[model samples]
Target: MSPNGSPDVQAITRLVEEVKKCVEALALPDRRAALSSLRSAISVLEDPEEAAFAQIFQSPIYNFAIRMGVELGIFRKLLERNGTPVSAADLAAECAAEELLLVRIMRVLTAIGYAGESGEREYVASQLSKAMVVPYLEAFAVHSSEHSARAAIRAPEYFKLHGYKTPVDSRNCPLQFALETDLHFFDWIHRHPEKAKRFNVCMTGNKLRRREWFEWYPVAECLLKPFERRNRNDSAFLVDMGGGKGRHLEALMKSFPSTESHLVLQDLPGTISSLENLSSGIRPMSHDIFSPQPVVGALAYYTHFVLHDFTDERCRVFLRAVASAMTPGYSRLLLNEAVIPERGCPPVFATGDITMMLVLAGIQRSKRHWVELVESAGLRVVDVWVSPDDGDMEGVIEAEVAS
Candidate 1:
């Protein structure tokens, strides 16, 4: 009940309590049912505007909370302590952060259901928070926060001051701008070792999620099967252009162990240098695909989630480079990306298109758009294969260099 003693408030409170009970009951046996119930409760409690606002505002708030967690070394500390609860003051002391700041961050986390506050200053990690603590997932948190902060900092000046309508209206987008000013993302991070380390940690953390996708889709295996049939000396190479840190390549190797292949990881000079200590079967090369692709005579050139990062013109340049670097016959170009469907599709990919607009001036393209883009690059779309478990927007598109 409200302190104002409103009957409507009392009724709503009772309804919310009832919904919670229903959620708990449904959750015991089936999580999907519980989630549906929770969604229903939200719909009942919140009007369309309120619900939309809650959904959108959560990204920035959650990013801020995650950034604070990273800065305070909360995940490392929690992992070291075996996921035990800790007081805010004690945590602050351990991380050398201010107690009040830690509490403030934890309070936000509690509100968002990432953590739970038991007493005045005591806090415990929740299941959701534990997921964030896992190293690979934690990288995603770090990336989200870093990208959000960079975008926010530039938003006011580039958008408001310049009278730009939206982020896309700005020249080069936030990421491209950052890259231009900072000598590209990998270059800047390389010069600043600390930032580079953080970036690596964040990227590696986020890789954990995509690693699961490989198990179901097995794009790596599918692409390598033909290569494995060839002679040992006539091995194929999965050239991951713009392959930062070879995370995808590592996953590919793990999936197709018998495929006698080499992983050619091409990126900026700085990123390539960082791979000096990388294990065997992975050859890190420093070459800008925008200039020219150096490697040739490969069985397959795999570009996973890299094409959508550029405009059609730029993507053509990239694909042209790939074509130039491949042998005429037997060589294939495999693009493992989301092939957006036109109608009756899920909202996540559509929403993802907006993020691309803000971050890199990239987009989630439909199959038609992909066909046009690849053809412009002198490549023909041979076939599109959807993993049994994958949704409409994501699939492997097999392509070949145009004659």
Candidate 2:
């Protein structure tokens, strides 16, 4: 063992080396399976009881340190100072923070690999510290500390009040109870535009999405090739229902520029406005999903990560609205979502499922949930094709107008 090595250090080193080796085997047939298995094995080997115990003891302090780091602008300040190391005294003077508290927080950050210790009492921005300035992530961290985490603290009481059942209404979730608000999630977002802006764009970044719908969705067979031969009229070839900023649509248009598919994007007005530089070929329409869909009888109506934000009752409304505009036997509705397992969902995605439940009163459904949803909406599930379980969130549910 190294002179300064502890069990935690040894564990982390093994974890990193194991990850590197597993990643190197990606060219093999079971790359996904290999990665999945590696992840499972790592979960046990990486977090031995000793490390878990240490984590439990250290987590509260870690949270406090990060919260203070975000609030006091330690990350931003350190980044602005460039590669130069800053002493605690200098940082406290600049940020007007208490010197002792600032030092403690900085120590925590450095210990956690967020920053680098330079000299005896000075610190320099590490790569992770520099990355912290990404606006959305910082915003999310702030939002978590300010909001959802607080709601989580009240979980036992909120659950008891709600009969220990899953909340199905945004206005009645644990967050609503914690904040003592009657407003639904979207209404609350509207009232707080600053938070809404950060929250909405968070998913658009590469961080949230593992793969694109076109990677799994039968875009070429379902929409593009049909569009290539179909008559081009006022109606768009594909209506990207609730597509935020048309990222997928943009990729489609770029991928098949010559295809006759005219792209249209329908989303809430506020979300649409952020697409000021929306590509020329795509049409942007401010339309609510609950209302009747204005674009009718398109080749396909595509939705990405949208339905996961609504309860089944609300989802039915959305589905029926889109269904109303579909031409029987001709139009298709493609839903891009995460098909969480009935049980033992991966930890990364389970967090998302929980967030949807608490924040939007929506759900991350399994295959059973998808079938019920489609059948309830007066549609038939033609196919539920999933990508190679890159173990990334994968679901591309295709439905057509009921016969």
Candidate 3:
């Protein structure tokens, strides 16, 4: 290790050179890939025991600490200091916590490289910590730490008790086991209004800084041009099923301001009632995905990350409902989800698969799995548009009623 504590300075320098080369001539995805490679190279230099300890203890502890920091507005307070290192006592005062307790949190944060240690008991916010000050990011940190992470810890015992069978029932999954409740995950969240709000915020947070679906999808070629040809005459152009708070519909409306078409956002009545500032052409409807889709033969019925929450049988029921409403060749079903590859899938998505298994009995679907699911519901995939950025791992599977 170097004096600055980074491993193998010469190796890192070589990796940095590679990253610089990629950044100058490559797209963002290639640049990100190079950066990932650099990180992997650096990680390989870690002592075996250190790595083991980090995986076994440091990660969980840091996750909890980050949530604690978020609850106390520690990241925001640090950002307010504006490059000045604040003493633990000052931070404690700001957060209304004991100085010693604040110091303990700070120690872990600094050690984890989220905060900079300028002097004894003094901390400066790092870029990551400053970024956490964003509302959605903060919500994700807190929600995941408090809910997902805790439930994940119970997953092993959940599996052991169930004789290691794969979880296919959402109502009786690991989340139910962890919370010791028979309520489905969504039902449980609904019962806790505050947590439900945080969860919705976290879901929105997942979309932040990522490319919008329209950015990668050929929207005009697939939906608009055809709609104009038919002159659908005030018909719904897009129906975002299970759309929470109309975020994606808002984006769609904004993206195509000149197009005078109906954009519908559907969710449960409770979620629809709370929506505010919807774009002029957008409509909010109280509709459940499992129920018969009330809007028939829309140009496109879009569902984002919705299908991954249930078993194949449940998904089949929902898909069949949408299929019955589709207008043959005119109507389309667009599913935005992580299309997991059959082999060598990214760790982030693999981790997400396990988390979904633990919490919602959902499995991230590969292209093959998606095709099977679509066909089983009397729908056929038209085309799949994957985002060029691998980090996003999101794709839109366009499907329509089977012949």
Candidate 4:
């Protein structure tokens, strides 16, 4: 084998000829029919659209039911009595609500497989429903409901008053609209300290649910491993630029304990101050990355679910600030954002992109668009790793300072 103790040239030539024959056969009429049959058989294995639509549309109903159940302490009540199937009338009596209203909501949940109906009026908690009984998951439902309410309340006013043409009018971003109308989400919640606490609890709940996905993060593991092995003395920092309340950092730390990293939870002053007593090992730093990132000397800077919140210009500014913080050779940047597929990929991210656009004048980027953004910020893309399960919903792009 060309002096490498492998297959020789003649053997390689013969193998290539055999492969060419196979390729030629794939083009033949009978082989084409076989290929078509194989594809049809594969499609029967899973109906993707049926699963996706159910997930996207029915999720809100399930979330709402969970929130209502938590509010009424239904799960806790059931668990106290060892998860016995209780009557709707009894549940309503306990919560001092109308039985009909409670049953209607329960019916929606039962249809979606969250709860189980026992005979005519009785209900039993399913495993999924039991999972929602946890304090964190309950709080998450509340938080999601709060955001939904905020969006609903503002949508009509935003459309009529501001001459807002669509949900994603560039003039009125979600952050700007929330700030203008609600005077910032947390700011309003700050007045009610209990609500603020619930908000944090809800944020933490989302982290708990999705942190497992990080283990499957291909590029994050690949890029961070080198630093963990090489740099023994200095703690390599992962500056989570715009990391909301250090939830992502907490998740990352849980997943990668050896990767010595500190979270720089950057946000608005009001948002930062509210999260003063978050927890140990999380240094909540207040700095607007859109202005100019103050803290430097980070090993690998990270931005997750942040870039899609801003317009392209603002995204450029954000990236430039990250670039400015980096020392040429050492620091690397990691972007955990969706890389919108060109054509053949699923429509989940595309639909998400539309939601972002409608809600906050945000747009998801394609790979080429991301490349442009990276290059524009004086950084060059090293590699991109897409999750096999998630397609491009949570892609990791490793970038370094451009030479």
Residue-wise C-alpha lDDT for candidate 4, range 151-195, written one tens digit per residue: 654566656775756443354545345446534444556778887
Writing each residue's lDDT as its tens digit, candidate 2 over 1-403 gives 5667645767778877887777765754467666677667667766588778866788767777776777789889989987999998999888889899888888889999888998877989998887677766677666776566777778779899878998877788888888889888778877998877766655445335365667656677777677667666666777888887777788877777753347899988988987877788898899998999988878888888788888899999999999999998888888878787787777767887887787768788887899889989899999887766456657889899889
Model 3 per-residue lDDT tens digits across residues 1-403 = 7788867778768867876675779777776787787668668868889988879977888888888889898998988989998998899999999999899988888887778888999889897887788788888887787667878888889889999998988888878887899999889988999998888777766776589999889988998888888876778888999998777887887788745458888999988998888766778899889999899978899998988888899999899989888999899999999898889787889999988988888889999999989998899998888888867779999999988
Over all chains combined, what TM-score does candidate 1 have? 0.71
Residues forming the 10-long window of minimal summed lDDT in candidate 3: 252-261
* TM-scores for every candidate against the unseen true structure: 0.71, 0.84, 0.89, 0.65
Question: Candidate 2 vs. truth: CA RMSD?
Answer: 4.3
Q: Against the hidden true structure, what lDDT does model 3 obtain?
A: 0.86
Candidates, ranked, TM-score = 3, 2, 1, 4
Candidate 4 wrongly placed segments (more than 4 Å)? 1-67, 149-195, 209-237, 243-286, 340-355, 388-392
For model 2, what is the error of residue 19's alpha carbon versus the real structure, in angstroms, after optimal superposition?
6.4
For all predictions, the C-alpha RMSD in Å is 5.8, 4.3, 3.5, 13.2
What is candidate 1's CA lDDT for residue 237?
Answer: 62
Q: Write the per-residue lDDT of candidate 1 for residues 1-403, one digit (tens) a residue.
A: 4577655776877877886676655523264445556667768868899778976887677778877786677756654665567888898999899998888888888888777666788877776767777665666566655663575456556555546754432244665454455344445566787666666676554333232345655454555565665555645567777777787777777766654247777888877886755657777788887877777777777777777766677778788888887776568887777887789555667767765765766777888888888888888888776544433356667788777
Indicate whether candidate 2 or candidate 4 has the larger lDDT. 2
lDDT against the true structure, per candidate, is 0.68, 0.80, 0.86, 0.69
- What TM-score, to 2 decimals, does candidate 3 have? 0.89
